[model samples]
Target: MKNTLSPSFSRRSFIKTSALAGGGMLIGFNLFQACKPEAKPPVDISQLNFNDFNAFIKIADNGMVTIFSPNPEIGQGVKTSMPMIIAEELDVSWDNVHVVQGALDTKNFTRQVAGGSQSIRFGWESLRQTGATARQMLINAAAAKWGVDASSCKTENGTIINANGDKLSYGEVVKEAAALEVPENVTLKDPKDFNIIGTDASNVDIDKIITGKPLFGLDYKEEGMAYAVVLRPPAFGKKLESYDDAATKAISGVQDVVRFGDKVAVLAKDTWTAMKGKKALEATWTSDSKLENTEAHDKILTDLLNGKEFKTMRADGDVKKAFAAADQVIERTYESPFLPHNCMEPMNFFADVTEEKVRLVGPIQTPAGTARRVAELLEREAEDVSVEMTRMGGGFGRRLYGDFALEAAEISKLAKRPVKVVYSREDDMTAGIYRPSIKYRISASVKDGKITGYHLKEASINSNMYGLIPNFFPAGAIENYQVDVAAYDSKITTGAWRAPYTNFLSFAEQSFFDELAEILEVDRIKLRLDLLQKVKGTTDERIQYSPERLENVIKVAVEKSGWGNAKEGVYQGFSAYYCHNTHVAEVAEVELENDVPVVKKVTCIVDCGIVVNPLGAKNQIEGGVIDGVGHAMYGDLSFKDGEPQSKNFDKYRLIRINETPIVETHFIENGLSPTGLGEPTLPPAGAAVANAIKAAKGIRLYKQPFIKHMKAKAPLG
Candidate 1:
């Protein structure tokens, strides 16, 4: 069935009206939508592009329907689930629909992004109302042409039917609808009447993924495009001093060797030639060896714990007095090191630049930001620059930084030719932004075997959503709560890595809670439940978490896993956290052999407000658990003198199929507006696994990559 355009209430419209009613562009909330035609036009599938057209619906002359997604598709299955929302309201057969990727037009696309798991949730209301409104307009046109009451006509399977048994195909009625005025507001279907939504829709791009179709940024190729490789500095803030391009120019297929900014680019006929030319060139780098090495970095972090001047993130009541009055105080320190993204495809971009216009195509998370920045750097108007987004091998927050896109645009402009900058696996690992290293110092007071107060101080490179989110932690919870965060700025660049600070914070907070439970001689589950009970209804100045949702996820997890009464020989640990509007609880089961902890199983319970696509949601949770476990046990990025220590997979290890853990996922059933799933589920696995290690062996694992030091600890038995 061909899906038609509709008129409905949009949050964008409401926000725009409110903004206008107040003043001008105060919040920079620009509304992007499909252009309203002077006279209605039929939905043409092939006319879809990233320019000024947002193809919410495309009806072929043959009646086949297509939905264009403005967001990038990584492994997340957004390519399948978002279309389901439109199909539901359009009342079309799923078998007749096709999904496509969106491009880099800020005026046409709806905030092109696949991160934060907002693809389905953000588009849910807009797409549904669009489809429903379009269907009504078509039915009205058909009824008017047949000289029958619109109430007597029903639309089903792309056809209009009357009570008199007369029928007309949607294709035959398109002309009349094209001439009709779209209604002001179209009624939406109730949740109970949904057919295509709330179902497990298979990923529309799965076949392409499995068969290795050309769908990723790495696979993108433009005519007359030559691959370029940049020779970056060995250390952060270091710049190129000089380079001898004799050998590179001597090589066959090597083109002009141009210097752009801090590095020289080796332009060649293909990726292999560019790489070969880059390796053959001799370049000198001026470095500051005074930069903190791995050992020095650790010492600085450890010393911060002793300092008296730490920034207060959260504080309530009197923490010093509470500690003084307590009969017992238990304190511990936890540490986590930097980690690389290790995306499978590496970083790549295709850029074509000229005096009049420039075109950029790649796997980028922020198309609008890239366009704005590129136009600024090129000294051109924003409209002259067009971005085409492709599927990323993986995002994990690295793509949002726009480093690769900027490099590609600069190189193409300098080379004055179409260029595709391809980063090798070595380049990707060594030159990418890393998850910041952190130190967590947690202290809790236990009076008469009951917890009284808690204090947590975290120090790390600040790459968190500090400015983006209104508040880092909810204002309510512990009465004498104290959270102090210290930002250590360095020459080393940092960016978001997976769930950001939540990954390390969860590990530290949940592990500390486990220790507190032991000190108080109370059940861990009961302690958390008690804390939730105390903070649930309490008031705070800012927005606090909903106690009911917090308790619900924990309750479901403990009950399903038989938390306190599990079978002997199997040790379990639990951790729960909230991020990006989603709540997740994870339980890890593990066994220690020769003091090395191996995760045997993981059970995850998620409350993402609403479940958009059941299968896709499960995939994200399961993948997050595995990814987190792998990173905590094996991932590490250290530096020697000022240079990165590990450059390839041989030096850095990864979790394989044989080492995979059995992951079980469950979703809290509800019709609430959906939240995010991509990053929230990832933050709890490390903390859960660390807690399980403590449960198995009466020892505390306070640092990341636990295997490195676990062998010297006590046995599980």
Candidate 2:
């Protein structure tokens, strides 16, 4: 069966057209072109003009096709996969396609942000249309030349073939295609006929990344650009009172010291000098609010949970009545500490601000929004600012906020010269914007050996879970289900980190489910299957997960992991979750050595719809699993007097290479449009390992950094 492009293009909606000076064609589709009336084609074929399109495809006389990807590249492989989508419909050989990053152009592009792993999901259809439109136009041109019906001509690897054996390369017909009217309808290839989509393709930037070819933000440099390092307040609740840079002025390579609002910056010829000058300056700080500590945070969150000030996120049925009639009630509390993004390339941005315009170049997840913010801060029109995005070392939700870029813009405006702000490891760690410490209290009611009611309460430092998360798993499966949220506002800063709320919440809920299975004396896998069976035909539109897809992944994980069939000395744990529009299931295998449980391997099953670039998809799944397991085992961040306690890797703990377990990944291909893959596989990893440890050693763990609990239970020699 074949599928035609939907919505049928409007006559007023045309692919913005242009022609290369060297006799080639340029065709593109603006995401918002449907809203505007199409302009008439230019009379001059050699100089056709269109400036409104965002994503573009250019055919060169040398048979090369260039694709412009309009989303930020945050190590999520969009730079590679997006172009593949376009090339698949373009009917071009993969070897002749080249990918380039498109600059920030809010006027032409839509959804230039990269957070939430939605770049591919949002751009899939539009990108395919861009290619299919270009290919159709090329075929029309060749058909006109051969005096045959356009439908009778077919394209194969950048060449158009007529039914009578006449042929023309794309480059040869591009000139005539530029003068043809944009087709109102174009046919899209069936998934079964796809050659470049389902097949594996290496990352477009793999060679540059491996060869260290100045691809990351930290590698960006400009002539006569001054390096600046800012000195922020030591604690979250404190503000700078005064600063004296008399000694800093004497340092070699030092240019100037400036202050902006509550922070001071030292500009020098190089990053090392800027850092050295920053250390030499003296500063005083004053408290703007009460200093907070980890102990205080714990008490505040616990009080919030016990208080009656929670806002109900979702309520499915009469939870009170269900709980009252239940024969048994089970409850537990889970705690997780704050975490840092810890990107391999620390925070950095380059800004060149002047009277007329502002230029920014760096690794930013939200390029369009950041440019707007810079314009607002500088009191300039949005059109006066431009942003260029570089490949990021890692984002993990850290680069979503543009605070670093703002600092660079402010400093550059003050100095009247281009400036690049760099952060040392300690600066990156202590400057705040961390994952909020969170606590989850879950309660479930059991009646006649079956679950009846489910209630969950979330308490965090600054913000609560997003509004849509409560409608995820278990919302439709359980009849009497309720979700509540509470928060404590603090001077400490916090934002999204990796999977956000679900990272810890999944562990809490999944671990609690394991306890429920134990109490009911039912097979854990069967218990989940039974729950999913109840939601087969749910009418709730608010429910965000697919029961059928989730069940399939769970079953696949069970079979691949050989659940309940591990060899001697090996125990297994299972967890299944859905988030970021993807369904994932994970199983952890554990073994005990000298009374210490060690995780040996993890089997992960994922259903993220169509797999674009299998090699890149596997990397995302494996990386997410390792990050989730490592953070659950050893990651922790504490605060003392409103200041982060761990300033560097020496004080903070991460998963060591030797401790990392083998990760086995499996994907369920349903041939649907691709969903997010970067963060979906991460949320279930912690719970799988925690449950496995419980089976291996008969201990239930509720706190993160599971190593702490293991050490407390260890016996003296």
Provide C-alpha RMSD values for all models, in order: 6.3, 6.4
lDDT (Cα, tens digit) per residue for candidate 1, span 199-283:
8866665545565767788898978888999898877757798999999999999987989877889999889999999998898
Name the candidate that leads on lDDT.
Answer: 2
> Any runs in candidate 2 off by more than 4 Å, and if so which?
6-54, 465-468, 715-717
lDDT of 2 by residue, 1-717 (tens): 655664354323433221110011111222122123343322322243322222467776545677776677888877777778878988999776666677876544667777786777766777777788788888998999989999999999999999988889987888778667778677888999999997887676665666566778999999999999999999998999999999999999999998999999999999999999999999999986679999999999999989999999999888899999999989999999999999999999999998888999999988878998998999999999999888888988889999999999999999999999999999999997888899889999989999999999988898785322798888888899999999998888889999876899999989999989999999888899999999889888898899999999999999999999999999898999999899999999988877777789999999999997898899999999999999998899999998899999999998888888899999998888888898988899999999999998888989998987667776512
The model with the greatest TM-score is 2
lDDT per model, in order?
0.73, 0.84
The alpha-carbon deviation from the true structure for residue 283 of candidate 2, after best TM-score superposition, in angstroms, is 0.7
